[model samples]
Target chain A: METTTLIGQLPEVTAAGVAIKAILILAIISAIAGFGTYLERKVLAFMQRRLGPTHVGPYGLLQIAADGIKLFTKEDIVPQHANSLIFKVAPVITAATAFIALAGVPVFPDFTIPEFVPVLGGTFVPSIASDVNVGILFVIGMMAAGLYGPLLAGMAQANKWGIIGAARTAIQFLSYEVVTGLSLLAPIMLVGSLSLIDFNEAQSGGFTSWFIWQQPVAFVLFLIAGFAETNRTPFDLLEHEAEVISGYATEYSGMRWGMFFIGEYANMITISILAAVVFLGGYNDFGFIAGWIMILLKVAFFFFLMLWVRAAWPHVRPDQLMWLCWKVLMPIAVINVVVTGIVMMV
Target chain B: MENFLASLFTFQGFAFYLFSFLTIILFWITVMSNNVLYAMTSLASGMVLISGFFFILGADFLGVVQLIVYVGAVMALYSFAMMFFDATREIKEKNTNGAVVFVLGGLSALMLVLMFAAPIHSESIQALYPMHEGVGNAQDVGIVLFTKYLVPFEVAALMLLVAMIAGIILAGKKMDKSLTEMMDEDAGEDEILTQKDEK
Candidate 1:
C-alpha cells in the first residue's frame, strides 16, 4: 500500500512511451555521436588553421553521412589467427555498454507526446529510460564494463600491438574508475542520492547552488578521469597511433572499427552529460535562460571542452597516466570526499 | 496469443526463469570451456547475470555493486593477468586423481547440504535492516551497514589494506631500478662472468 502510494505520486509514464523514448534516445544519440566526429574534425582543423572536410558539404556538414557510407561499404576483415568469436563480439560489447550507460542518464527533460500523434499520443515520456535508484553507480558500472571491448579486441587480434593496447586499456580504465567513483562521491554525498534526477533537483536553486562551486576539486578530478575513461587525448594510450599503430584497432576495419569509434564518441557524450548534470545545475533553469536550453549549453560546453583539450594537449605516457591517476587524482578525490563528509556532519 | 505475450512481458517469474537459465548456462560454459579466455569471460558474464537476480529482488545497490566490483574491476584484473599467457591456446587438464576428486566432491556436497539446511533451520532469522517504506535502496544499505555492520565492514577494509600492502611488497622488489637498467645490469654481470671464465 505504501509502495503503491509512493509510486503513484510520480509522473505516469506508459510502457509504450518509454519504448518510444528509448528508441528516440538511441537514434538521436548515435546520430549525435557520428556528428560529433565531424564536429571534432572541424574544430581541430580550425584550431590548426586548416579546412576540415569542406569538400563533402557546406562547412562539411554531410561528412558524417559520407563516413557512414564508407564504413558500410568497406570490407570487414578478420585475421586468420584471430580468436574469431571474441574478435567479432568485442566491438559490439563496446557499443552496447556505451548505449546501456546512457539508459540511466537523463538526456532531456520529460515531455508528453501530442494527442494528435497516432499510437503513442498523449503518452508521457521520461528523460531517463530506467530511473534505477542507484543511477550514478549504474552508469559508472556500465561504462567500466566497457573496458572489455578494447581489452578483448586487443587480445583477440593476436597482434603484439593489440596485446599492448589491451594491457594499457586494462590499467588505464581500472585506475581511472577508482578516481571517477571517488570524485563523484563528494557530489553524491552533497545530494545524498544516487539518482541523477535527485542531483538535478538539489541544484534547482540556481547557478550559485551548482555542485561545481561546492566540490570544484571533485569536478576537476571527474573531468580528468572522464577524459581518460572516454579514451580522449592525453590519456588515449589505448590506441595511441604513433606508438601502437592503431592499438587494439590495428586489425579491425569497416564497421567493426567504426563501432569502436561510435562507442568512444558515445562514451564522450555520456561523460559530457554526466559532468553537465552532476557539476553544472543539470536541467534547471538559469535566471534568464530556460532549463532545457541551459542543460543543452552545459552539455555542449563539456563536449566542446573535450575537443578543445584534444587540440591543445598532448598524449601522456602510460607511466605518467597511471601516476597521475593513482598519485594525483585519487588522493585529491579521497580528500574531497572526506572533507565533504565532515562538512555534512558538522 | 495476446494473453501469452502480455504474461511473458509482465511476469516477474518469466524474467527470473530466463535470468536463472542464462546464468546456469554461462557458469556451465565457464567450467567446461577449454580455453582460459572463454572460461574467464563466461565466468565474468555469469557473475553479471547473478546481479540480475539482485535487481529482481529489488536490491538495486547490491546489483550495481556486483556489476562494478565483480564484472568490472575483479574480472578486468583477471583478464589483465590473462594477457601474459597465450589466451587462444587450449588449456589441458593433465592430472585427475580419483581419490582427491572424491574428497573435494564430498566436501563440496557437504557444504551445499549445510547451505540448504541453514536457511531451513534458521526460520527465526530477521533482517538487520528491514526494508523501510519510502527509503531508497542505497540509503537503507548505508544505514544498516554503518549502524549494525560497521565493525565487520571496518575489519574487512583493514584486511584488504593488509593484503594490498603485502601485494605491493611482493611485487615491488626491484622498484628502484628501471626495466632497461636492470636488463643492462644483468647483461654486464653475464659479460663479467664470461670474462672471468675465459681468464
Candidate 2:
C-alpha cells in the first residue's frame, strides 16, 4: 500500500493492513454513528437538567452500545399484510446511503488515506472515499437515493396510515429538496468547483472569510433546508408519535426501528458536517486546532438547536408542509439564488 | 487471475449483457403484452437499463440526463396518459391484429439485425466508469449545453413547448374542469387569466 504523499515528501507508514483499511473505515463510521445517538440524548438531557442515563454507564456513554446489542438481537417481524421484501430492504437502504455520503465529505484536510496507519507522523492523506472533482453533484444524487428509503418503508409497510405517511414523505421530500438544491447552488457558484477540498479552501482566511458572511441569504436558507432535510422537530413530520402514530415508522419496532432512528441521526451528522463545510468554514478557525474544534462546536450547536426546536414546536399539517416548501422556502431560496448569482458575478 | 475475471465479467461486459436482456424483455412485451401500458412501462424500463449501460460506458451526463429526462419525465407523462386511458389487460392487445403483428414482427427483426450488424467502434464510453470520473461542476455542463450544444438545447425546449401544448389539447374536455379547480385553489394572479380565457 505504499504511495507518494501529496507534497511528494517521504513515503507514509502503514499501521493498518491493506485488506482491512476500507472495512475499518466502514466499521468505525458505523460505530461512530451509534455513538452519536448517545451523544445526542446525553447532551439533550443535560440541557434539560436531567441525568440522561445514569443506569447505563458513566454519563450514559454505554447507552448507544447497549442499545445496539439489543437491536441486533431483536426479532425482525414482518406484518402479514406487508410487502415484506421492500420493507426489509428499506432500512438497509437508509443506513448504507450515509456511508456513501462520506465519500463526498472531508473529515480531515488532505487526509484521505489510501493506506491506513501512516508511514510518517500520523497524517494519513485526504479523508474522503474519493477525491471526486464532481463531488457536490454526486452528493446531491446520493441525497435523492435517500428519498426512496422512507418512501419504500412507508409504502411497503402496507398500512393505510403508512400510505398516508409515505405520501407525506414523498411530498415533503420533493418540496424541501428544492430548497436544499437551490441554497447549495449559491455556494457552488461561489467556489466554482464541485470538489469539497476546493470548497474548504474557499473558506480559508478566518471567521470574516466564511461564505456565510458574503452569502447570508444562502446561509439562512441552507440552515432551514438542512433542518427539514434531517426531519428534526418543527420539521419532523416523518415520525410524530402522537398524531398518525410514528408516521412512516408506525409498524417498525426493535432493530428495524433502531436502524431507521440511527440512520436519521447519522443523516443529521452528515448534514451538520456539510453545513459546516459550505457556510461555517469547515475545520477552518481563528487559530490551529480551533478550526476543527469550531466545526465540532458548530455541529453540536446545530444538534442542540434541533433538540430544542423538537421540544419547542409541534408538527405542521401535511398540506401546510407542502405549502411551506413550495410557497415559502422555495421562493426565498430562489431569491437567494438570484441575489447570490448577481453578487458573485458583479 | 483477477484481470482475467475482471475482463470476463468485466463491468462493461456485464452491463451490456444486462442491457440486452432487458431490451429483449421489453421488445418481447412490446409485441406480446396484453396491456399497452405494460408495454410502455417495459419500454421505459428498457431505456433506463440502457442508460445504466451508458453509465458503465462512462457517459455519466448522458446516463443521468437520460434517466432524468426520459424515465423521470417522458415516461411519467406517458404513464399519466396510460392511466388516463385506463390501461387494462384487454385493450393493450387491442391493436395487435394478425396483419399489424406481422408488420411489427418484421420491423423488430429488421431493427435487431441493424443494431447488431452496425460496425462496432469505440471512442471509449469508459470515460467516467470508476465513479467521480466526469467533469462535474455544473459549470462544465452549462458551458457545453449553452455553447456547443446550444442549437440542440434550444430545439429541445421548443419541442417541449409543442409537446406540452399537444398534451393539453389531447388531454381533453376534463382539462377545463381540472384547470378551473386548480385555478380555484391558486386563486391569485392566474385567476384573472383563467377568467378571461373562460369567456
Candidate 3:
C-alpha cells in the first residue's frame, strides 16, 4: 500500500487520546524502570546464588517502593566546587531524553477506549506516540543526545574521577553511535522506510520474514551497539565503581541520582524494544502466540540478556573498548551495509 | 473572548513562537555568558531549538539530523574539549577592535539581506525536483539529493574526507607514546635524577 494512505487508514488519534497515551507511557514506563531495578537485582542475585532485597516485602516485590522512598527522602548534595547549574540539569537531561526517545517507540499495540469511558470515550491511541514518519531516526537521535547527561554531569562535578568519567563517556558514546547507526542501516535498506510501524508491517509474514534471519550480522552488530549504547555490563566502563567511582554520577545523590538510574533503565527498555521491532518479527504473531505477547516476550528476553551478560562477562579496559568500537564493530557494520546493498542489487 | 483566544492560539503557531522564544534566549545566553561551559551549553540548546523549527515545519528528517549531528556529536565533542580547559573559570576577553567588529557585522547583515532577496528577485524559481505526493519527507529528500544534487553532495563528502584526514594528521603527531607510559617515564627519570644527586 502507498505510505500516505497507510497512515490515513489508521483511526484518527484525537488530541485527548494522544495526551492520555503520553501520560500512560510516562507513568507505566517510569514504574517499569523502577521495577526493572528490582528485577535486575533479583536476576543478578540469582546468578550469584544469593538472596536479593528480601527484607522489603514478600519475595522482595515492594523493594521497588522502598527504594523509591529512600531515593525520594535522601538529601540532595552538591559538591562545594561543582558547577551547580549544569550539575543540577545533567540528570534531568538524561531522564528527559530517555523518555522522549520512547515517544517514537511503540511499547504496545494501539487500542481505542471503550465508549463507557468518561473523558476519552472511543478515542483512538496510537501504539507509537506521535508516529512521526522518521521514527527510527528520531528515536536514535534522541538516544544520541542522551550522552549529554553523563558528559555534562561528569564535567560539572569538580572531581578528578568525574572528569575521567566524562572523558570516557565522550569517547565511548561518540564511537558507539557510529556503530549503532551503521548497524541499523542494513535493516533500513531492506525495509525501505524509516518508520518503525512499516518495519513491523513488512515482517508481518511469519518467523521466516524476520530481519534477524536475513540480516543476522546486522542483528548481532545492533545488539552489541545497543549494549554499549545502554552502558550495560562489559561496556559499563562509564560508571565502573572499581575505576572512576560511579563515573559521572560520583557526586550525585538522592532524587538526582535516582533520575540517572531511571534514565539508564529506560534506555535499556528502549534498546530492547528497538531490537525486537527492527530485527525480530516485531509485534507480529508466531503461529501459536499473539503479536503483543510475542513482542513482550522478545523485549523481556533482550532485557534478561543484558543482565545475564552483566553476570557472565568481564568489563573491558578503556583502550580495549575503543578498539572494539572503531576497529571491529564499526568495520563489520560498514561491510554488512555494503554487502546488503549488493545483495539487494542482485 | 473564546473565539479570539482560539484564533490566536493555533498549535503550530504556539509551538513556533515558543521554540523561537527559547532559541532567542539560548542564543543570547550563548553570546553573553561569561563561563565557557555555560556558553557552550546554551549554544548547544540553541542548536536543538533551531531543529525544533524544522520539526514544526514538518521536516522530520532534517530535524533529527540536526539533533544527531549537531547536538549529539559536535556539541558533545566541544564539551569533551571543554573538560581539558578550566571550564569553571570565567572567560575574559577585551573588545578592543571596534572597527573590525563593525565591518564584520555589517558584512554579515549585507549577506543576510542578499540571501533573503535572492529568492524574491528570481523570475521563475522552481523546485528542481518537486516533492512526490505519496512519498515520506525523508524519501523525497533522498530522491532529490541523489538525483538532482548528487555531484554537489559527493563533492561535499570529498571535502569533508580531506578535512578529516588533515585533522588526523595534525592531531596524531605524538600518537606513538601513550599518555600513561609517558607519565610513568617522567616519574622514573625524576627518581633516577634524585638518586644520582644523593650519590
DockQ of every candidate:
0.56, 0.12, 0.55
Rank list by DockQ: 1, 3, 2
Worst 10 contiguous positions by lDDT, candidate 3 chain A: A1-10
Please report how far candidate 3 places residue A18 from its true position, in Å. 0.8
Runs in model 2 deviating more than 4 A are A1-25, A46-51, A108-125, A290-294, B1-6, B9-113, B119-140, B155-199
lDDT of 1 at A226: 96
| iRMS (Å) per candidate | 1.5, 5.9, 1.6
Interface RMSD of predicted model 2: 5.9
Tens digit of lDDT per residue, candidate 1, span B1-199?
7855765686676788788789989888987888767777778778888889999989999999999888665556565556556876787767688999899989988997898688776878887668999999888988888998999999999999999999999998987778877788799789989999999
lDDT of 1 at B50: 85
Candidates' C-alpha lDDT:
0.86, 0.67, 0.87
Candidate 2: tens digits of C-alpha lDDT, residues B1-199? 7854676586677667768777888868865765544555466556656667756665555555564445334323442443344332245334546898799879988997887766454444353423333455355567777987899999999999999789868865574455557767877877788999999
Question: What is the TM-score (0 to 1) of candidate 3?
Answer: 0.92
- Choose 1 or 3, whichever is better by lDDT: 3
- Give candidate 3 regions above 4 Å deviation: A1-9, B1-8, B94-96, B109-126, B173-184, B189-199
**Ranked by TM-score, top first:** 3, 1, 2
Candidate maximizing TM-score: 3
CAPRI-wise, candidate 1 is medium
Give the per-residue lDDT digits (tens) of candidate 3, residues A49-146: 99988987899999999889999999999999889999999999999999999999888777878899887788988778888989999999898888
